[model samples]
Target chain A: LFAATTVMADPLPSWSDTEVKSGIVAFVETVTDPASDDYVTPSDRIAVFDNDGTLWGEQPVYFQFIFAIDRLKTLAEADPSVLSSDVLTAAAAGDMETVLAGGHDALFEILNATHSGMTVDAFQQEVAQWLEDTKHPDTGLPYDEMTYQPMVELLRYLRDEGFKTYIVSGGGIHFMRVFAQEAYGIPPEQVLGTYTNTEYAMVDGEPVISKVPGIAFVDDKEGKPINIERTIGRRPIFAGGNSDGDFAMLEWTTAGKGPRFGLLVHHTDGDREYAYDRESPIGRLVDGLDKGPGLGWTIVDMKQDWQRIYTGQN
Target chain B: LFAATTVMADPLPSWSDTEVKSGIVAFVETVTDPASDDYVTPSDRIAVFDNDGTLWGEQPVYFQFIFAIDRLKTLAEADPSVLSSDVLTAAAAGDMETVLAGGHDALFEILNATHSGMTVDAFQQEVAQWLEDTKHPDTGLPYDEMTYQPMVELLRYLRDEGFKTYIVSGGGIHFMRVFAQEAYGIPPEQVLGTYTNTEYAMVDGEPVISKVPGIAFVDDKEGKPINIERTIGRRPIFAGGNSDGDFAMLEWTTAGKGPRFGLLVHHTDGDREYAYDRESPIGRLVDGLDKGPGLGWTIVDMKQDWQRIYTGQN
Candidate 1:
């Protein structure tokens, strides 16, 4: 009964009493214990989390893509030429079939057009306003509220134990900066992701940084590790991800010479949330799930492991 | 006597009783005082410092360029054909006159050839080993040991007030990361600078990030603010710098809507260190000095402001 009570008090409250949960608890304990040989210093305790499917609902396409489509519509109303581009037209019409058929190049065009050419402040204000007014179509909850409750607990727990948590996502860096601190307690400086090129210029006697229409970097798959190296300069001790897009980050992190933890949030709750793997077009998990055992990465079964998904908090 | 005792207890011991020193202290106090309207939350207290002349010595030439020249010499010994390239030959001969004669393009070629194509770990190991072995020719001290004592105290003071200090420089990001934590208390992750392109690949079933011979980004002049926005996603409240290279950073930082602080480290003690601003080949400070008063930037004169320069800690 005492053991059961203590287990209920686990740092990860939403996580059930499974090997996956215990693994996280044990890893944190060993690395944080001052007397332990595996103890990692506070400065060295960096944990990187993927923000999309891993932390929140990314189904039916990424939240950023939705924001981009909405932005395209707004721009088209003011300047109809924005809709002349095939990709922008397809995106505004909600035709995912056509949008995906054009592939990544088309995606880049749409993203660059929607995400750039504005003052940094104006872009941030627009993103903040959109987040405040919009909701997930399926959940009927504010997009920020769609964040996984278990992952939020994990982030807080790690920070409580002196780890610096960072969101290394594929979303636009500035897009995440809008609500990341309010929603996740991670600062803007700690959020690293795909970037739009920006230029500094004196406009009307005021210094302003304007976003240019191009991708500076893409933080996905193999790009994750490279971007991490470029920005963070230190390899993360803990890597949390949801799909094959994060496989390289986990691989690079776990390969480091130290006690490391790699977690893959497997979507297995079709009733509570959307269950997905392998065949999902958005964030496929085939390669990572197949090699999870070999890589010693914990495969978190959402249906069995999580007691709840969303906790009604931003 | 009481007033003198208070002066002795200054947070910046190396800085004399000057307006520049008082400006820093007053700014910190107001922003940290909870009762003050100017009070900034600890999370928003981001401070960025330039590396070369701001933190350490950059006398004869920038230190990283010296490192590149040394690397070229070593590489040329192994492969004589390395010297066949005009830039490589000039660099290996320690002929700065000839190297600079070829201009910025030649400089980039030399930097790329010397700084890329190795595994990340190997490059870090080489840098670490070089820092351990080499010393500055003029100072007869390890390059890291040549860091300004006044700036180090300022860093500690800011951190003591809950400010997160970051090194924002035009120097090679990886090169600075090798000794940044040891030389100054700033960690690698907190340091932002110019970067070499990198790629993640599986070598012998092990993941490795290899540096590619290309300029990914240059954190100089106009590039500073853009890169800062991309990586940090925050507009810094305090920006410290030493040359025209840091002009854009200072401009962007001071232009923010707040009680912002901008500092320029002006080297004026040629006897103690080296001082050749404006027309100096390295770390020129002309436009910044002319615009300093208008921007309300605090200029620290090494001759009059600092009681001591290098403390030889690193």
Candidate 2:
């Protein structure tokens, strides 16, 4: 009933009546129409999306980094040893300039210091509580409310059409899992992201998966497609992203035989959402902009294509 | 219709109606019954099983090793350089004594030599062809026909009761994925096991995941639960395995909140099937035998409990 009504009316009301929207709708219809030569089985209609810039706003910086910095500040209040190092001190203080100057090492070090040595359950709770208590510095809105309205509609429409949607992000898996279900209607299992090594133990007769200090794997660059293959075990038919980090995933997804769709969310709306692409420190878009159109990918101009940005925003 | 008929009649026909069967049935009923206090939603009804001795027979050496040895022999026959080392030569020649003398390193080396440097699609095809042609030396039955009938029935029953079944194994993931669906009704994404590092490349406008050399991760012991958490993102309500390698998976599963079920398949029928437990070179069963029952795990006596072992054998 939901699918019928949505298909009858505008399936994506937030999406403008443009080539991008039509392209997406047409591709979905062609794959799902059964009679079409490009018809794909329901089980094969897998769609993967990058979380940070594609699903939500990543301007100012990646929100997860903000989460880490804020979390470390509170943690350091109790145990100052968490901020013993100079780089740690700068990151916990929300000094992004200094943190960025120290490069990726400083950024990851800050994350690991605040992220590890806790139970998976406890860390999850921490993320949940932070999402509840915290707000985006610029938007002054809850993190969960920051998800793009049009993308959420797309996710719902795809799911209704018998597609299994997943978030393949560089964000922490445990962290994204905290609110992914409530925010985007994507379940925890379908949310794949960067993960850390965990130790399993019986503590007080209860099974606990403890988060250790170290990176198991980073789900970025080529790691995106590799992790997708390992975890999903199927090449996705549809993929969406907003940065170069997701270039390989989109490339791989669309390169498969038969009907495939790749959508690149170009953050071109400076008034509605901060739009800095090529020079942006986070979610820098380069290769995707250069090569995406040639591969028949639909590049979404956020300023023109989306009627709304946030769920209730215009 | 399948669920209704199975529920009215014997859901598992291969069993001789023992407590082992009753325990599994009762637990499944309690969780799936929506009115019951222990009722779990279908999304949370995740059931994980270890592939090798649990889903299919692993005796006369892990069947995957036989596949590797067999596959290696064929590869070496064409290109003698494929067996560049003494251990490689012995493994290719099916000299288990020499391979065992060299230990896990030799075993893994042989597997890598035959396993890596191929596309995932090609490796899957190789495994599929091998399963099609190869028969058990002792039983003279096709490899796919060696699955336990009672366990397969249990998997079907649980699935009928709204459980999502998964295979967490110590075997090669790509190899087991070849026949898991046809033989055990488990899908590729749901089959987790030892995996190798893979590189994603666009060759001639086609995306290919090449199986590169090097062990990515081994899904055994603690890795079973970790992989479960990573892939499924939920604690399984039920888990089953045959040896000590599955001890941690079962232990961690049964320790979860609310009602849970753990099953250990005790290979005790020496005449019907080769049965070596405590000191067996493969599928060792010491820790599981000692502490499983105390932790409320059901230990299936293959000789007494099962009226039939293989799908059509008694």
Off by over 4 Å in 2: A1-7, A312-314, B1-7, B312-314
Model 1, runs deviating above 4 Å: A1-8, B1-8
* lDDT at A184, model 2: 91
Candidate 1: tens digits of C-alpha lDDT, residues B1-314: 78766644578988888988989999999999999999999988999999999999998888888888888889989988877677778779877788899888888989888888898889888888888889999888888899999999999999999999999999988899998888889898989999888889999998999888888888899888887877788889999999999998999899888799999999899989997789987999998899986999988899999999997842
Residue range B1-314, candidate 2, lDDT tens digits? 78766647788988878898888888988998889999999999999999888888998889988988998889988999999889999887778799999997997798789889999999999988888888899999888889999999999999999999999999888888888888888877788899998998878878789899988999999998998888788899899999999999998899988999999999999998878799999999999999999999999999989888897465
- The DockQ values of the predictions, listed in order, are 0.88, 0.76
Candidate 2: give the clashing pairs.
Answer: none
